[model samples]
Target: MRLLVINPNTSRGVTNRIREAADAMALPGDRFTTLCPAYGPELIVTEQDAALARQAVVDTVRGFKGPCDGIVLASFGNTGADPVRALRPSIPVVGIASAAFATARALGGPFGIVTFGKGLVPGLQAKVDEAGLSDALLGISCVAGEEFGDPGEVQTRFRSELEALCADMHQRGARSIVMGGGPLAGMARSLAPTCPIPIIDGTQAAISLIRAVAAPRGDHEPRRAAAPAET
Candidate 1:
């Protein structure tokens, strides 16, 4: 299945990191293409950034062609998920926050989100409420997702940061931690075992959710299929 993960931020550095991580986690047979917005903020953290990214995503949805089996916003704020869904109305549009809400509810308790910064907590919490999982939400965490770099850098930072995060979750009485955002996109296997409860990455959840949502209809005429028959 061909899935496109749209990073509405202009930062290729961040966009590349998110793409590589998504590629690594995707199931076999799942093809992912990641691209950043031509015009938008470097990274989307606040409401203003989200608005900028939203405009770009709106344009993308309008111009999208090819076989897009599923689409992911590749953002914690989920700037374009709903809009694209409303616009496209065919392909399943999955967002990190929505997927996290699903994973959170499934984990069987209030889920806490570990985002880029505490400031994002309001927006993250709002997403939880919007997903109708507010009743099952615990709260947010410490290590800001935007601070995390590549895998090696994340390992250096997360080796300690993750441990502390887990400890904090334990203190908060959270039964699960949803590592939210593309920036905090790190290996889930290593953290899952040690965490007090379940450790879920919104990136992985969003990817898998997009995969499970079912591929788009092949009826949308592909260039090859649309070619006139040669008599």
Candidate 2:
């Protein structure tokens, strides 16, 4: 199966990180093509930043001429996902935020989100409400520091900060946690082992959803057939 992954932000580092994480989860025959728009915010933290990134996402999808079984919007906020879906109704378009929320719900949560930038909390919270998962949401936490700094440094700092937040959420009745943001995908994978509860990475969650969507139905599954017309 083929998948098109779009990073709404212009940061190549984040885009590359997303690609690497997705590659690790890809099946032998599966192919993933990841790209970022030529222009957009390097990192989206504020509402204004997200607004610009959303436009870039829309433009990128509008200009893309590649063939793929599905598309993955590799951003926790799911910028431009609604427009993308509306523009391409025949294609499957999965967003990281929705994918992570779905996974968290399946795990029977009260799940919390741990991400960068305190400024993004409101947007993240809004997304939770939009998903109709407000009842299942525990809370949202942010790690201090620049969100688009060196990947290794960011991950190291995030791990320490996130661990504390996760523990706090656990005490607050959170059953699981979602490490939001596509750039933090690697960090999520690394931190999951040490976390007290399940940590759902947005990228990984999206990948899992994409695989399920691309997979063939079981032989016993019923197929929809056309009705016969009387002559």
Q: What is the TM-score of each candidate against the true structure?
A: 0.80, 0.85
Candidate 2 residue-wise lDDT, 119-205, digit = tens:
668878898999999999878888775443653245565667777877787788889998877768766777766777888888778
Residue runs of model 2 more than 4 Å from their true location after superposition: 145-153, 215-231
Q: Number of clashing residue pairs in every model?
A: 3, 0
Output the lDDT of residue 172, model 2: 88
lDDT of 1: 0.70
TM-score of 1: 0.80
| Cα RMSDs, all models | 6.2, 8.7
